[model samples]
Target: MFPYFCLLIVTSFCAITEPFYKKQKSIKCILLSCFIVLVLFSGLRYDVGMDYLSYKTWFLSGRGFSEQGFILLTRIFRSLGPTIGFNFFVFIIAAVTLYGAYRFIYKYSSAPLLSLFIFFCFGQYFISTLNLIRQELVIYVFLGCLLPLIIERHFIKYTLCIATCSYFFHYTALILIGIYFLDRHFSAIIKLSGIALITISSPIIIYLIENSDYAVYLKLDIFVAKVTVLQYYLLALSVIIALLYFKCFQGKPMTKKDILFENINYINILFGIMIIMFSNTPIIQVISRLSYYTMPIYIILIPNFISRLSLRSNRLIFRYAFILLYTLIFLVAITTNGKLQHYVPYHSIIF
Candidate 1:
């Protein structure tokens, strides 16, 4: 727990203060190296999360097609030290995802550091690291890899292929298929209006799901349980983002990319709200996992918005405020429900 807290604090601090040096390759290299070291160290800890144990057992037993790809990949590392090797592999996947996300933002927006900070601050990545949900992690990495192509050319075929591979890793990735179409077509006003409607009607959606016959097929309690806290954050964050968008609107006209990104954010907010509200329902609950797919876009969009700010003081304040908010959230998440564990420090140097 201490190690985890330290990592979050250091990461968040660096994210806030490091933006000025983002163009420096040395800074990127140093930060990247430290991140890798943390990943290696994290492997030394006991398998704290049930998700890790289940995946490890499945890999060891030569399980079915489910997780076969991940199993096959990890099997090679199993020869070294199962837990450490598996952690290394997961770390590489996450690193690649982060790099891909960085490249995506750099390609699309002028402010890459802001984009990276947004991604880091999002609680999902921090919690997922501790939980080690390999499938979801892999899907996120793949989505990051697919971002450049999706944003530049808007090619449906390639997008579908990437989305398919993501779904293969985790069925929840399928929800992103809807997002792809939404990005391509939806206008900002329409998207935001739709999200507002969803937010307003969330309780009704939850009530219907709780009472509906479809509840028999879907076990929504787990989904509901997971989403309650997440929803609160999502709602707050969405409102903040919407306010930013409106505040920034008069200064610069929205670009095509900006519109696309805003629409994506709106869809994510809507999806997140639905998941939170209807977590007790069957199909709607399953839809909640789609939040991960939309998570990166916020990072991509928010930073770009921040970067456009003209005042240095505003940027600094915004950066610190965002980092502090996320850092607090990250702490609360790990410490909640006795989820934190005091396992061996997962450093690279072997003891």
Candidate 2:
């Protein structure tokens, strides 16, 4: 708790004061320093994170894992000598994850430090890197690579990228290809209709899965659903904020670059609506995983949305309001989320 709190304070200060620095060099240096700290913090953990023990055990035992990429990666590391292979594997994965995150922030975020802060504090994404290594790797790849392709309307490239990533990492990443259609180039009717189709078909999909031979493999458990209250709050807030932004800033002249954030915000709203619709259903897990593909965009969406404001007072109010809200969420996650408790009393190999 102490270590996590320290990181929160330090990163929060960096994020808040980052705008004061005018030079890109200064900003880059700050980002690099913070990035290094995050990588080390994530990479060097010892007996921390929910899957730490399992990952280490699997690596040492030479057991095959579900993801082919994880299997090949472990094999490559195992050849390096038993003393360092497993730990180094963890370190390399951490580096890749943070590198993807940093690239995404550098490319898209209006406030990179604020984005970094959210990467750390928002729903414990930083901590999640230690647990869902393969999934997070795929997620950041989507953020850094596939998302830009979606914005650029490069359907072929986006499809190829998702295919390659899904083959290597988490297969769930294959679902990301659907996001390309939700781009702003498409008509509002098409976008809403697509979302509506998915929403309406969810029940049929769930029923078929439940009745199919795959049901045993999927292990769908209504009693053990993992969707959290904080997640619900975040998704609901995102929809409310996007709606308010839409209402307040309607018809404002949007720069071409603003379109990117607008599209992301729009997708976030659409997904948020879908998740809320499934809030009571047994398939919330399925809906929630699908929604998470776009949820990380909230870090970029909120800051950039604030920048679009016409009034300085409104921007300031919204900025602090978001900071306050996200801070409370971080606090709640650390104190309450049982899985997150595994991250505390922060251990490191070097220590």
Candidate 3:
């Protein structure tokens, strides 16, 4: 909680001050503080995330490395002993993921620090460092590589990035590639219609996972869960936000670059909603897994949409509205300690 608030203060303060802080030195300090708080909070924490023990167990056992890349990574981490190695591994993951996200938010967002705040409100960074370690690292790294290529419409480069990411996290990376490609190419009518198709097909996905011999190999059991009502509310909120951003862009005059970036984010939010809707079926966790690629869009889209509004009064109302909205989301996340995602009270091996 201490580190969490520290990060919030830094980002929020910088959000207000960045426009006036023109000096390169001042800008560096602000950015440094942001990364410093993020790294320390996420890097030093011990026994915090739900998967902490499990990840430690894997490190100690020296297993679960699917390829030479991970095998070498684990070896390097464990060279100093399990605890030290695990913390180092965590710090590396935290640094890489947070930095990548910083680039993503800074590149596409209207308010970079505020977009980061939204990322914090959603608990994206903490959960990535603490719980969903391998998957999140792979996804963000892959995502960073994918964004530019996607905008350039360089399919070959995007495919290579996906393949590279697969080396780190395997089939999960492939799943994201498939989902994102479809989202990018699909028309609005087809996008919504495919949602219906996916909803109807879940039972089949479930049936195959439940009874198929391949389920064990594919690890489909991990995704088994019933979608809750709270998730439905979140899903609805996402749809509203996506729609709002889409409509916001409709009336604006923008360059091809701006339009391309906004439209990509538009796809991200919409696809994220589609994936969340699919959670209502048997393979609930799969949607959660898939949402990672698309969820970052909201961090920027929300801020971008509000800033691009036609009325000053409307912007003010939404500014406060989001302040309240993010505040509640942040508080609820803190109270839960990421229990749902397996994160919580800050702990550190060094302490």
Candidate 4:
């Protein structure tokens, strides 16, 4: 974890300094290449999260074929050797995700440094923390590509095509389709109102899931479980931060593209809140994974916002605030069984 932190510090420093260098292109290439290699290496030896074990079993059993196709691919590699296969899959998916992230940031924002900073600050540095699951990671890669296209035209057909491809990896990707529409049409007030209503009704929703026919349809089998209160609190806090961010940035000189990016983050916050509030419901749990689809949006937006600070005094204040927020979230995540071992000393290097 400390190594990962060091890498982040270096990446952040490069992003800050390279823009002023005569050989900016070369420096950017080296830093970006290093970042990519780090992600691949981290995934290579790390244990594929236990969540993937189910996918592996399903693939080997020839059950859930549609949902387990990526796992099937990994299983074939596993036949060669479990470690070899797992790492290979991890390397490929992580590489694709990193490329997608780069493109997404480059296309959406003018400031490369801001984009890189956002990438490091948000969960980009923690990509290897979760067990390597091809589907989720692949969905993110596809979304990263699909997002730029959607932003260019806001076309429904294009959005559907991307959503379909993402859903091939995880049905939860379908939720992003709804989010795209919400990002286009929903206002901040409506979002806040919806969140408030949901919060107020959470108890009833919880009760209903616990003792209603909907539970059967939701498949409240052994597969479903309740989330702890701490999880709920953290999710609620995320929503609060998102709303505050929206309020802070609203009516600023931000472009539609920027607004769209921030809206995606807001959507993630809302999705996380819904997941916690309805954690007992398997359907919602499955749907809530869709929030991961927009994780990159945070990496794109927050850092861009940070880079806009001109005054040294303002930069210092914003930097500290950013660090504080990231620390709080990182601590919360680590406390909740999240480990960072996979991401440190990223060992895979293409060179």
**Winner by lDDT:** 2
Judged by whole-model lDDT over C-alpha atoms, candidate 4 comes out at 0.57
Provide C-alpha RMSD values for all models, in order: 4.2, 3.3, 4.2, 5.1
- Give lDDT tens digits, candidate 2, residues 1-351: 787888889888887776577897887788889989989988888888788888888888767476676678788899997659988988988998888888888888777877888888876477778787888888888887667677667889989988878877778888887767654444468667877887787677767876987667446454335546766677676667657656765776555445555566677666665666555455666666666666787777667767768897887677777777777878888888734558776788898
- Give all TM-scores, in the order shown: 0.76, 0.85, 0.79, 0.70
Residue 44's C-alpha lDDT in candidate 4?
54
Candidate 3 TM-score, true structure as reference: 0.79
Between candidates 2 and 4, name the one with more favorable lDDT: 2
lDDT by residue for model 4 over 1-351, one digit each (tens)?
555566556656655554455664775685567557556544553443454445445544546556554445656766766545555655666666667666665655545554565455544234433453545455555555766555666567766765655544665556556555533646658878977887788778767776976667556466575775544544664565565566677766655565566576666666666776766567565544555566555555555555666785785566556555665554455444444333333333243
lDDT of 3 by residue, 1-351 (tens): 666666666666665454455575666555556767777777777877777777788788878667556667788889988777888987888877777766676666775656666777666544455678777776566555566776666777777777776765455677655533432333578656756676677567657765876556345445446555445555665667657645765655655455544455555544455455445343456666566665666677777777787796786677667766776867777777555654545667677
Provide the lowest-lDDT 10-residue window in model 4: 340-349
> In model 1, where is the ten-residue run with the lowest total lDDT?
340-349
Best-to-worst ranking by TM-score: 2, 3, 1, 4
Instruction: Score candidate 1 by lDDT.
Output: 0.59
Q: How many backbone clashes are present in model 3?
A: 3
